[model samples]
Target chain A: MRHLLPRARRGPAFRAAALALALAAVPAAAQEGFGFGEPEAEAAAALPSAGPASGASVGGELSFSIDAFYRAEDEVADLPFEGLAEGVLEFKASGTKVEAFIKLKLSENILGESPEDMLDEAYLRLYLGPHSLEGGLLKLVWGKADSQGPLDVLNPFDLRDLRITETLERKIAEPMLHATFALGDFTKLELAFLPGFEGHRIAAEGPWAPAQVEALELLGIDFEGYLPDTEGLEYAQAGLRFTTSSGPVDWGLQYFYGRLPTPAVVFIPPVSLSLSYDPYHQLGLDAAAVFAGFNLRAEAAANLTEDLEGDDPEVYNPSLLWSLGFDRDLFGGINLNLQGSGSFRLAEEGVGEVAYDIEADTERTRTRVTAILSQKLRNETIEWELRALYGIEDADFYLLPRLAFDVGDAEIEIGAGIFGGDEEGELGQFAESSWARLLLSYEF
Target chain B: MKRLALLAAVLAAGAASLGAQGALGAEEIVRASRDRIQADTVSSRSRMMIVAKDGSATERLVDQYSLDAKEGKRTVIVFQKPASVAGTRFLTVSNPGRDDDRWIFLPSLAKVRRIAGSEGSGSFVGTDFSYDDISSSDREVEEDTHAILREEKLEGKDCWVIESRPKDPSFQYTRMVHWIEKGSCIALKAELYDKKGLLKLLEFSQFKEVQGRITPMATKLSNLQANTSTSIAVEILKYDEKIPAGVFTPRYLETGRPQ
Candidate 1:
């Protein structure tokens, strides 16, 4: 059997640093003493009394799920059944001048796979008059769009499984220092610096691995994935953003210096290939407004990669990316959200670059459109939704339909993913990975 | 006999003139009743109970900060309970001539989103109260024309029954009737009517004096068509608190902290 393998793992020291960053937030919260206050009990005690200006709380959620799939092709060795359990523990505290939050995710596959436990986010914030300073492992969202925005580049994504597509669920937080200063009435200036670097988390040696890796192995070639070195200061990223409001519209201007998280293939002689991340600079603009009962969001960014002239075959070319979308309520309480995004490659005459091309079909402009329709019934206890994504240039599409209902403090959700179109398209590669899922979760 | 007749006619004319003037006084009474409590700032923590049609209810803890700014009234509300909606914040700033500006931050979204002002009639987080109902206490007096319907005794207290019709055709309610306590100027009860007749009923009770100001500590809004009701009982209430100016901005809504 052929397999795609990762050539690197983060060192123990880096793990310790991550642990320390998470642990450091505990003391700030511990000073106030952790209390598991029952929300119902606290709210029932309606007393007119003055309480302390500081407090701490601990809470979490636990969920279990089962997934089943039907295979149509032998893309990879098929195992149709999987079971998993996940938990999230969170600690939060706030004082008159300081606040802290820490959250951790614990997951275990009941099928006997190794557990994947990680810190979701841990941050300490200090308030100084009209300004604030926060530091720790954090996930900073920068764009105004509802999803898949062009300017939301601060965090790397976890793409090990294509089934998980929620924006917050897919983001991988990084260590950073973020500060915001109030600039008059409806304006703010924000600055952020990430001291270390990390890239997207992709699975190795599985049906969920990148399709390129699997196709190359089928043709008698070896594929390897390399993690970027995090020890150097050269990999650090920094950004600045200015946000303000004019009339009913809110807009922001941002500039960032960072490495693109997407992996690019580098051809090694003697029938070898490796994936690497390339450095890039991005200047972006985002705006949001409500017009005639519709919420409209737009974001545009100019990504200047190392291959500005598009002459280097190994490096990805510079591109202009934009997204426009609107959210509105239609036909009673049902909501409809639509977004269209496009990326236009600059100097597209490059010799060796393929976006969705397994057969060397390079397109200068790639467009994708997404739509989501959702409704809540029975006092918001029952939720039904349908989400669709279509790649215009690649002629591929993905559809997800879900139904969720609440019963006695527990929510049960059943969903299915369907993929179709050209086999070489980005989403179509997962045609065989399409699956149905059932999840039951409870929160306290 | 002619002199006696003239006296009766003069008395009748005097009564008609006074009745005509009484109609003009209704607007002032409404203006005074709505603006009864004058405070520079208000901060409070309250428990919201959303009762379903089946009588099962859920509670949500909320913190609210409000201030009368130079531009207009500004208010912020933060949710701290139910786990699912914790850390959700909303900010609304009233504009003089245009529609108000509103923004909301959802923990799941992790960013502040601008919402349209036309959602005034939408339900407030699955509650019976609408977005306009939350800010109805601060509605401008001139927006609606009011008339004194009659004087009646409600719960052994004299109240002026007034009928109000909004000038803006787009208002969620076609007309409303309010029962205002005579001396306190507090609206004890109100019935809102839509195009399809009676829609909802609102009642305010549990009057208390905080910082020498008469405040209602309990409020309930019931949707007649849905057979559901939401009640908010204040756990802690304060008046004229020192709320920072930065607390009303979108930044505070996103961060859940001042500035």
Candidate 2:
């Protein structure tokens, strides 16, 4: 589902035409598959705080980082060059039945004089008897899927990001109050209340926007604006999750009552020219287990949107989405991960009735597969990885081979990506957008 | 085993008798070494340094917590540093008859995944020590056949050299030889061998007394075949310390805080 932009809330200070972008790079990229190599202790240990000589724990850590990258890609692919300097201050206090944590981020862009994003996360957590309460901003990750999963629905993704340049950890945190009650030894019941909501960040115009727009034209619909706001507490998004572990298997059942993070167009045309985060309900089941040598994981979600019957093409439609994957070590140091994910329209009405060739549309999903193979070498100081994402039905694919070296307190990464197959397919749209990039980051 | 015990008493009183040492069977000596360092809980923060053949080194900060349970010992290791390995946690719970239940939590994926087998023989987080090496003390004596090699004096301390061969063919090491200090019963050194021959050399030093318990502050593992080694020095250590039991679960893996 996709939607239109609401009356523009973006101020003139957005520097919309700046030739540079505010890089959203997250340091979590190099920390793949449990991570390798060693880190210095002097600069890494959490800030010291004296406990009862032994009882209650209270301490905090402050860290600063500088990141710079040089890219050789075309104008529409993304910003040509970007650099950011940021500092993270985190404080943690744990005592009795209470454990609190908060992180404040301060950043400034080297190129773009645009505004800097601040206040990364702040949360206060209390443990009362068998229940827990947490409130403030948080990046809550869910589901068992490896890289991507339709069942991982709690947080909204940063759509303005460029791959490799920004890690998936760039996901925006939501203002939420979450609670969990222990039901048994390996089970817990979770409830969350999200007060503020935002739809997916859709880039106004870029090389990637063409295919999406073209697909709409084929459906005899005109793309317009997008609206991302929802009312306060009374209409707040809410969710419930039941999680349990049995022997070697871990599983969870989830239910969410909220607006779809993505949008459905207001194809009811005459009245409004905007897109919105339509109301929806979802039921999801996810599980993970390691048998033989493979670490198996799977997730499935069935969503009920505004157009449950699929009679309206302009509204969001009901759909079933799922993902299955496994990870295992091969040879001595090579690690392999493979995943298969897919989504299906619940009914054949409306746009589902329109038949377009594989190359004509990228959003028309049937099946997609992703694979990641990484090898640790040079006494685990050097890492080499090859990642692939393919649209099986559309015959479109993207490949990226990257290398990273651990030098002192910093990591140097270099990589190149290539896109091929049907030009209208998701990955294939970047067929001519291929480019190489170099990134250097140091933490202290 | 009785004859060996008698001989061991004889050696303790007067000499170095290899034949008498054999009388005490390897299993009894191993049991003493394993049970000597008794404690309800253990907590420590260590700095690990890995040195390659070229003398280049990489360092890591690690915190380990272990508690003795009814079944066996439960251990957890967390890496906090360099941004690359930060927020990574590995948990291993020992079982009486089974190998172990192992799991790892990586912040990147933000999930706790199981490590299928202890026999995989892969290095523990790129270190020279194998995954099983971290829990070798918890391995049951019945899982292997033991025999005393001899009594030797090295580093000016009397030592009983015992050899243990795994009864299960699928085990990672074919055989292992340990140097158990005569009176203290602490393993000062160990040699591991596979089908190809000697694989690793482990040495423990910097013994210190904490909470009335003798603890080793330094340990080094040398990968003989690769000419690489890793040394871990405990910066802070506490024995019989109180650690919340909740830290053993995945919840602590994400929060780094014990309930």
* Residue lDDT tens for model 1, B42-133: 67777888888888888787777777767887877788777777878878787888877888899888889998653667666766766666
lDDT of each: 0.73, 0.64
Global local distance difference test of model 2: 0.64
TM-score of candidate 1 relative to the true fold: 0.86
Model 2 chain B: worst 10 consecutive residues (lDDT sum): B1-10
- Total clashing pairs for each candidate: 0, 9
lDDT of 2 by residue, B1-259 (tens): 1110111111111111232234355677777666555567666677789898888888887777777788676777888654568778877666677445667888666666666553347666677766567657656688889988999996998888889999989888999998887766667888999989999998888777666666677888898988999988877665666677776766666555554
Worst 10 residues of 1 chain B by lDDT: B1-10
Winner by TM-score: 1
lDDT score, residue B136, model 2?
A: 70
Tell how far residue A427 is off in model 2, in angstroms. 1.5
Q: After TM-score superposition, what is the CA distance of residue A33 in candidate 1 from its true location, in Å?
A: 18
List candidate 1 segments past 4 Å from native: A1-52, A72-79, A95-97, A110-117, A205-207, A217-230, A268-270, A352-360, B1-24, B167-170
